[model samples]
Target: MYENMDKEYVLNTYPRNYVNFKQGKNATLFDDKGKDYIDFTSGIGVSSVGHGNARLADALSDQVHNLIHTSNLFLIEPQAKLAKKIAELSGFDVGTFFANSGAEANEGAIKLARMYGEKKFKNKRYKVITLEHSFHGRTITTVKATGQDSFHKSDFSPYPDGFSYNKDINDIYNSIDDETVAVMIELVQGEGGVEPFEKEEVQKLAAFLKSKEILLIVDEVQTGVFRSGEFLATNLYGIEPDIITLAKGLGGGVPIGAVLTIHKDIFEVGDHGSTFGGNFLSTRAGCEVLDILEGYKNSGELDESFIYFESKLQEIAKAYPALFEKVVGLGLMRGLRCFENVDLSTLINRAFDQGVLILKAGRNTLRLLPPLTISKEEIDEGFKRLDNAFKVLS
Candidate 1:
């Protein structure tokens, strides 16, 4: 019914998995037919606190009863509180602008950088330098910001100006010019097969940008919010970016995006706004996610969980060298680089049939973005299913 209904009504944007999930509990999902699957995708990293989290549910429910949205024209308590919490956790004296998705957050960040360049340089610098294989967002401007050509190949032509891509530091240096306003990058290129940037290179780039009075924008939509063993990937790498865009796992299972900046005075009245951003329900959910993460941190459980998942991934890579080339990424955000002959889509489908839901990152990398709240038992079970899938594929 869903397959036919989706074909009739929904636009064919995604080649979705065959199963239609009916319910979820923690890292487990139950399809409409009552078939259970270990969910490693976490709805592409949105359900960080895991599915059916009572705390998030209660917070969202209470906000729904009280007030869901009051527009940006009016002051909202949850929005303010959530912003403050994010600022504190970000470990920077920052200001935040809320949006509805990662793309919107990045769009806001781009606008902020342009405004900052205009206000400070008075030279109308607008060009932003991004890395090759980076994925920022899907908006016209963001599609241009995204360095991959595949994302912009179709009818979205006459691509937006002021965006350039670089493969390395030399490419970045060459791309920078008098009109360059900022350099935006994803610390871990999640969609680009969970590729991680070298630490020294990132630090050097940040320093170079600072020396030139250029802003550094880190797209942490997929790497932030405790997905990388730290609250922010910047924290993990010790890179102090001027602006950071966050979404994906920010509101646990709810949709919320944010642009955080250390440059507190980047925006003025009427400079930027989002009508549905930071609504009561979304902010409440964001606050609850932060609370859960804080608890994990304080109890030393976050580190433990990260170690457990990392070790398990390493074991899998070592145990199955013929299938997995290597395992890359930090914390629960990992990727299994498959052998050249391996068909990732086929493996994913096989895994799905074997009661395990996973995702592909690039062409040959099996991306694993399990909930930070995933347990040891769930990890063991998920790996067992994956092993079974591998055997079947073999």
Candidate 2:
């Protein structure tokens, strides 16, 4: 069976739960044994338009049958179109650098910040300030950029320097020295207990940093691409970041990442590149995703979907305050912060056993990043399963 083969051949990197999905329909996934489960993860918010999407499948299939990869050596059609589409949707009149994952996008953004500092500051000002509990990625330098200590294990000791984690603006300012060049953040800290930064605080911090000429980098890797009811989560704070890193949901299940530089051109030829970054297939998939999202937006379906997602979570939290005392996050990216005595693992497992797939964040936050294309009926079914799980626990 694939399970045994996966256990034997695949690297034991992930927790690798007992569930093995065979296929998916909208927000529902079916196990190999034919049991159905309502998916609330969206593969950690990657499948923005839902799985088995006809438009996405058709686009990918056409791209597969035609052209897949041509590297960056020559011009690619979908890549160019996707870049322009991002510009149209985001209103960022700047260049975009393509990469393959969130880590790669963050890495590129870091390089851009450092490059900017190197060229403009006349002095060495390459240090980037990040917030505590922020999750960037798994790459070595990104691990260093991540604010969590747990990700900085002994195995990857002596992490690459030039990054600092701070909780408040005073702490960030205090930490800034002659080497500080930029401050990176996520408007909605998805992994950090689904915490949404207040717009006023974000505006204040952004203004302060701008006064110092320090660039602002928003890691929209998890919060971008209409996941938070906007083209980009950075728009929610009304701040135009010097650099925005996007991935996860951009490709709608395809592996693709991007670094969008807003009105700032720091990279020249031979500055940065990725081998499999902006391949034809990935860009084509991205185009289809945008098409689907734009369709949803135009038809008023997207707004309706987000309203349902948020209202259901709020209702559920109110219904089961013992298990989930509060709800946090914007749009579909949500979390239920548990009470002190609630065991997160038990609750997650209970939900999984009740034919529902879910995720967690921070210590006790039940994170939910369901597909944006999820229907109201699917939402009802998922909440029904969640109610069953909460009933067993509370």
Candidate 3:
């Protein structure tokens, strides 16, 4: 019924799987026909605390009854608390601007960067440099910011100006000029095939940009909130970005995005605002996610889980050397790099039909973004299903 209704009513934007999931718990999902599947994608890394977490459900329900949204015109307590918690966790005196999604969060970051550039360079600087193959967002501006042309090829004509891609430090140096305001990058280019930048190179780039007074914007939309085994990937790389954008797993499956900045005074009043950003319910969910992660961190469970998951990925790579060339990414955000000739889409579809849900990163990368709260048994089951899929594919 849902598939029929969706076909009739919804726009065909995504090439969706055949299954219509009706329920989920932890790392498991149930389709409408009651078939159970091990979930490795974590709703594209949004359900960090896992599906149907009772604590999050209760918090969201309570918030819904009390308040769902109170505009940015008024100060909301939950929003304030969540912001404070994020600041504390960030280890910096920072301010946050909430948005509805990663794209919006990144859009906010870009605007803030442009505004700061205007003030610092007397309106002479507005250009923002991003890395090659980086995926920022879907908005017109962000599509231009995205380094890949394939993403912006559909009706994205006359690309926005002031955004350029660089493949190396020399390219970046050549791109920089008096009008350069910021350099944006994803430490791990998640959608670009789970590729990570070299730590030393990133450090040198950040230092060089700082020397030129250019702001560093780190898009942590996929790598933040313990998804990378660290609270933030920037912390993992020891790079302190002037601005950071976060979303995916921060709200524990709830839709929320945030722009966090070390330089809080970059934007003043009347500079930015969002109608539904940091509303009561979303902030409540965000706070609950933080609370759950904090508890896990205090109990050392998160670290143990991270280690176990990484080791299992390494084991898989070693075991399936004929199929998988390598494993990339940090913590739970991992990718199994398939052999060059492998059809990753077919493999992912086969895995789905075999009662496992995974994702594709680039052309030959099978991405796994299991929930942080997923258990060892769930991980084992997920991998077992994946192996079964591989056997059928072979």
Per-prediction backbone clash count: 0, 0, 0
> Each candidate's TM vs. the true structure?
0.98, 0.98, 0.97
Lowest summed-lDDT stretch of 10 residues in model 2? 167-176
lDDT of 3 by residue, 166-244 (tens): 9754578788888899999999999988988888888888898888789999999999998887789888888788999
Error of 3 at 286 (Å): 0.3
**Candidate 2 accuracy as TM-score:** 0.98
Superposed model 3: Cα runs more than 4 Å off: none
Query: Candidate 2 residues 1-394, lDDT tens each?
Result: 7789998999999988967788999999998899999999999999999989988999999899999998899999999999999989987786788899999999999999999998888787899999997999999999999999889998878888888899855477678788999999988888888998889888888888888889899999999999888889887778878889999999999999999987456788898899999999999999999989988878988889888888889898999877777888897899999987888889889999999989989857999999999999999999999999889777
In angstroms, give how far residue 384 of model 3 lies from its true place: 1.1
lDDT tens string, model 1, 152-225? 88687988799988886557987789999999999999998899888888898899999999999999999999
Report lDDT per candidate.
Answer: 0.90, 0.90, 0.89
Error of 2 at 10 (Å): 1.1
